[model samples]
Target: MTDESESMETTNDESQKPESQGRMQILDHALSQARKKIISSAKLQLFQKHLRPIHKKNPEVLKRMHMQLTKQLDCHISEEVMLMFAEEQMEKILDDLDGVIASQKDNKEEAWRPSGDPQQDSRVYNISVKVKQKAQLQHVLSQLEQQNTLLRDHVALRQKKLLGTKRTVDSGISKWREINEAATSIPADELVEFVQKYGKIHRHHTMIPWDDDIDVLVNGSQKEAMSRALESLPEYTLYRPPLVQWKFFSKNITRSKRPFAWPYIDIFFFGENETHIWDKANRYTQLYMFRKADVFPLQNKPYQGSLQPVPCNSPRVLSRTYDPTLCTTSSYTHKEERSKDPGSRKTVKCESLYRKFPFVFRETRDHYVMETVKVGDCILYQTKAALPCWTESP
Candidate 1:
């Protein structure tokens, strides 16, 4: 039994020895690989250190060395490990390269100097510092130029607005002066007689500065006479409408820029109908009928520093034609006053509608009525009547 046990123990020892030999072989192979990897890393680091000075001058040497190192460490080291070492070596090489470039730049700058005196060196250093400072100043100057350009544009815009306002004011003054001159041209007796025979000057402020077109009214009988009188004047040009009243444009008074185009004075003519006053130019046949005596006996009123003919009962005439509230109110600036004045709001609507559908309806003293034509189907016809009486009072 002892001999059998000893033989069995020997067999077990033999099996254990083979397992230990396999592990030893593995360790030896791993150590050899580790040593090779360390050697390759050391070589790469040394090569990179020497490569910086000649990197620009001898690029072929760097390429050959890179190829050899890659071939030697290809499978011996993991790809990640090799890349990490390569990256570290590359960073060191870049740092050394930067240092060498800086030293070369300094050598070139020193070579350009005429002398190595302390003051000369200080001047060179100051010149470099000033170059940097000049660059900074140039950047700031560019920004300021942009800001200045914007400021100039803003100023130009404001100047344009101011000039436009000035031109408007000057034109308004010139127009007002022309209108005043035209109104004063007519003889006082003829003006008074015309006003008494027809209608008074409406919305003529006696003691205020009026900057609007001059308004005149005449009856059918006086229309030809007034037109002849206006046409006789050298400064006035009579604009005769087909069915409407005539307008008097001033030949002498023209815009500052436009010499041929002139501003005109409005002349309103009224024709008495069965129930209302008809205005051919305004296309409105309906207007409050006034007694001949109510608008007669014209009174002189101050208009732009001159006396002009006005109705004897101007307030009554205004109230009858336009709004009753206008007689009580001195100004029409307030919202409440404007709201109370139907003529002001209705006039705009009527004008807008008239422009849209010019021949649809005719206004009577009471309301608007559709105008009927003698067609087979009785079509509505628009009249070309000019209602100067609808002008708003200030």
Candidate 2:
């Protein structure tokens, strides 16, 4: 009996050993992460303190610095490195200021020294010192401004490169996939679905390139539920528009409320009836309209390596939303918030789309005709007085 009990105890001890080891490993990892967080917080505090005076003198520079810091932080860089870079910048500014101050002081002494007229000398010396300090401060501020601009450009270039990388683009798209999966928890009748929108055209052009945001369409009724669900998500923060409009409502979901929250999602709430669905007619001169069949019976479309539920007839929906010619032509995206400068716009050919789809063209000396291809057939033709427009031969 004694031998059996000892054997049982030994077996129990062996069984618990693996579990105990796992617990220790987890604990160690937690501690390490906690230490990093503490150190990062301290460094950030110190950096902010260094900028406090500069912020008081020139708030705009401080704002730009904060923006740069936000972008770098998003890149998963260590706060220690950022702090060091900031210190170097501050040091340079100080060095420039020191040199200017020294030169001004030397000049002041030579030009306005103690004279026989004490009162006059005192007034001139005070005014000179004030003017010298002002000039020195301005000079230092300009240097700092230029350095900030260069830093901003460098970080922006690095950021652009990072975003263009396949891994980063995949990661960004995966986030939308997660949101799509989470949205499925809602019932089908409520109509929560991701739509291709402008991104649909890009599918023919590029291999799921990084997009600024994703578009989601939900029934007007599901607004509250979606708001609650998105808020519950750890990765998403839902923002509702400030003003309420008839038949128009949207929720903007962002990763964070930072200065450069690039990749986000827009959830547009649509009003529906038995025959048709529409959004924001009063707000938009050309409201988006769709037949009930165009949206119902949501179909899965391949997007960014995942099969996301999209409107059944995406091309039809897009045609109604944007100019039909947009399918054949490519141009820089125009957003309401962006500057409306014609010089900034460029027209480019949808080479990928043109290649993938068949089209017939007619060329003449004065004009050309081009036909729009849909579903492997030439459907419509348009004439233009430019380089040979490809027109569908009837």
Candidate 3:
């Protein structure tokens, strides 16, 4: 009777295997579709193209399939999934941080070790070596403690400065929108269209939080008319930086290059080539050029509770100026060495910027840490890993 019951249980388990496999396949398909959709329309359509035959047969069936797929994708982002993501992220961060600390400790410990064989040396020499090793080990440990303390203090100050910078950025964006609205009356010929550029080309429609400048471009041919219209606006003071061939119009430029200051916008005048539009906003260094077609036929994107003009192919322009990819890690060089020579400005990575102006990129680092530690709050992560012996404790 026991053998017969065991056989029946095995049969039941075999019956469920196919069903489990089928469900997994469906989940895999859903995830693939969702990932493609997030990347770009072209990739999303690549999958949908296979369903063309079904659409031709009956439009209603295709519509239902699309709705079902969309529903599946939406439902996959459940709370449980989010919790799992958070947990995994936290684990990776803790692991990386632990690795860094452990490596440093190992290096110091290795350095403090006595060289040569103690057995082959004299008694007096051996005693001195022991004493020297002891002192070195203690010194190394002391340095490690100081390093940990400095790291903790740096992260705390960064968070505080970031929060303050975010508030200033929020207010600055509103002011930028107001300026955009005020300048609407400028003639079509003089304006030729203006759109958000540089750090403003984010998917969220918010400017790069730490950036203290708003970049915009207009027709270079209409510089005189553009200046006159800008001068008429009583609220803003227009200033052109002295000693440059390119006369870019800047509003309250002095407010920038300082911490927590109201971000000023620069209206760059771009010249039209046969097939490209160019801006020499970087003094005499080089012309920043973009395809005229990509820039023109501008589209409105939602920003700061209002729609604002952005280049049609933001990726095309952004890739040329910043990193090749549309969005990934934030990387751009803000500084130019004018002394290098005309048209020879060197570009620096964002990592260098982080070291140079630590306070400004504080918020970005917080986001990175939060993602790494799988904690939703920056403060919580800081508190969790504040101790010098955090990795050693467990």
On lDDT, the stronger of 1 and 2 is 2
**For candidate 2, what is the lDDT?**
0.54
- Ranking of all predicted structures according to lDDT, beginning with the best and ending with the worst: 2, 3, 1
lDDT of 3 by residue, 1-394 (tens): 1234535654554454334334334444444454434422322244347877776788667666665664565556544455774776744665666567667874644444444766645665778888999999999999999999999999999999999999877766666666666656565433433323544433333444444345667776766666676667666666654333223323544454532223345567777767877775566225477786666556554455456665656557666666732323323323321133434444555444433221111122321211121112232121111111111234
- Displacement of residue 319 (Cα, Å) in model 3 is 2.1
Candidate with best TM-score: 2
Please give the range of 10 consecutive residues that has the lowest summed lDDT in model 1.
203-212
Clashes of each: 11, 7, 2
lDDT values for all models: 0.50, 0.54, 0.51
What TM-score would you give candidate 3 relative to the actual structure? 0.37
Q: Could you say which candidate leads in lDDT?
A: 2
Rank by TM-score (best first): 2, 3, 1
Better of 2 and 3 by lDDT: 2
lDDT of 2 by residue, 185-222 (tens): 77776763543453452233223232333466678887
